[model samples]
Target: MFRRTFWFTSGVAAGVWATTKVNRKLKQLTPENLAVTAANKAIEAGHRLKDRAVGFALDVRDNMVQREAELGDALGLNAPVADRALPPPRRYAAIENRTGPEHVEGPAHQKNPYNRNEDH
Candidate 1:
């Protein structure tokens, strides 16, 4: 009968499909193939992690620069280009000569005894 023939064909097709799927799965589960698959997956994950870390670092650097700009503006360091007056030269107390009578460096430790230049 036509009905019996159709069912027989369908059953055979299903069995063949199932067998092919199982064979493919078994092949993938074999030691060498499984190791390769795992390694490939690990490489993919590492790439994704590296991309995320790079993005995070870039974001942090941008934020840091932006914050520094904000602080400079708040502290009035961002002077306009037109107001270009040179600041008065600064005099550091330590750098000034103190050999004058007002500030004598009379000697206990004036010249370090440990100085190899003087020793030589």
Candidate 2:
């Protein structure tokens, strides 16, 4: 009789413990809790994306250098393409001297006979 009573009490205690654990777990799985977890995951993904983009840019730059070296070998050129600097743009004369007054009297084509868009 004592053993039976002890077993029944143990069973009741275990049932209560299990119920409490399940309720706690259900609360943790609520919408707000889940949303917080999802937001944390999304933040982690964004950080990873930034890191991967930087890595990708570095990889592309390295690949470009390697390809440029290969092209130079194939073409038998010693100097890299980046060595050449473009010439500075030439300065033009005053706008008044080069082109006539801003407001012309006749149609644009009439004033400038050399206009390429002139009707044939």
Candidate 3:
């Protein structure tokens, strides 16, 4: 009778342990928990991306500062390049014709205006 009682108690304990473990797993895998985890990861990735972009900009600025004179000479900038503010974005007028405003209606060949059939 003692052996049967021991076996029964052990079976009950095993069942309880399994129930607790399954409940814990189910709680962890709930939709709310998963969404929260995903959101946290996304926020972390965004922060990392911003950090990398800032670092890249700093590196570019450093390289430009080191090669300021060479770059200025190549680009024909006589004054201090870093001090100069960037020019405002160019505003383009609306195209009113099929040829557009940029298309110059002039002689096809500027070199030889009289030669109409000149290879332009």
Candidate 4:
């Protein structure tokens, strides 16, 4: 009876130690922790890319404005034109008449132009 008790106690102690070690290892390899780490990295990268794109767009806009100012100065116009003047209307002759093509009927042209055959 004493030998049996000793063996059972050893087995229980070994099982407890192994369980503690496995639990520690699992804590280091949890899927939730890994997913959080990956998501944070992706968010950080996206923020950096967005900042760079905005800065580049601002630089391009500033360059375009500067170039336009330089061109306006080169042109003798004191101020930019408020609106472009419209050209004179085209003159049409009353005697000249235009004729359109005559319509023709055929068996193949009887199908509806706007109808799609999807229901069939």
Candidate 5:
């Protein structure tokens, strides 16, 4: 009789444990919980991708600066001011600054040929 009672108690305990475990699992699988988990994972992935893109951009900028320096050295673009070549003196036409008002047809605002409205 003691053996049968012990077995029965053991069976009841096992069933209770199983039911509790299943209930916790079901709660975790609910829609709200699942959506929160998915959103968290998506945000984590976006952060990782942004970090990778920023790293790649930094590397490209570093390489670009290095290449520009190399080219500047190859060409004498980085030479001292005294060593640099100068363009020949140019003879420019003298600019006339007249004091009189600029000649315009009708009112200055009305001279806007781009205006499509005749009412203006």
Candidate 6:
């Protein structure tokens, strides 16, 4: 009876060990499982990249809008003139104010030393 009980317990332990080893070996040899794991990792990486790209695009768009608003405010182009009567057209000064070597004649012949010929 003692020998039988010892053999039974040893057999059960061996069976359990063999089953565990076989399961481990089978898992190691399974290409489909590895591929599935790799695919899941790639999908997660792609999602992270897409999320970062969307965030960067939104930031750029917001910055562009803010810059445009600031430029419009600085240039006084945000709104139309308040009075109905149109203001006189702005008269640009002649380019001869510099009196440098780069001075040239303008199209209007108004002492334009820059000589930017508009007839072209």
- RMSD (CA, Å), each prediction: 6.7, 10.0, 14.0, 17.0, 11.1, 9.3
CA lDDT, every model vs. true structure: 0.85, 0.83, 0.82, 0.77, 0.84, 0.83
Best candidate (score: TM-score): 1
Residues 1-120, candidate 3: write the lDDT tens digits.
999999999999999999999999999899999999899999999999999999999999999887997887788786777877899999865434545433555676233345333444
Supply the TM-score for candidate 5: 0.59
Error of 3 at 66 (Å): 0.8
lDDT of 2 at 72: 81
Model 3: worst 10 consecutive residues (lDDT sum): 109-118
Native RMSD of candidate 1 (Å) = 6.7
List model 6 lDDT by residue over 9-96, tens digit each: 9999999999999999899679998898899999999999999999999999999999999998897777667733677999865534
Per-candidate TM-scores read 0.68, 0.51, 0.45, 0.43, 0.59, 0.51
Q: Which whole-number lDDT from 0 to 100 does residue 68 have in model 1?
A: 94
For candidate 5, lDDT tens digit of each residue in 1-120?
999999999999999999999999999999999999999999999999999999999999999999999999999788899987788999755443344244334565343355234454
Indicate which candidate wins on lDDT: 1
Q: Report backbone clashes per prediction.
A: 0, 0, 0, 0, 0, 5
Candidate closer to the true structure by TM-score (higher is better), 1 or 3: 1
Clashing pairs in 4: none
Candidate 4 error regions (>4 Å): 1-28, 78-120
Of candidate 5, the 10-residue stretch with the lowest lDDT total is 95-104
TM-score of 3: 0.45
Give the Å error, residue 12, model 2. Answer: 3.3
Better of 2 and 3 by TM-score: 2
- Give residue 83's error in model 1 in angstroms: 2.5
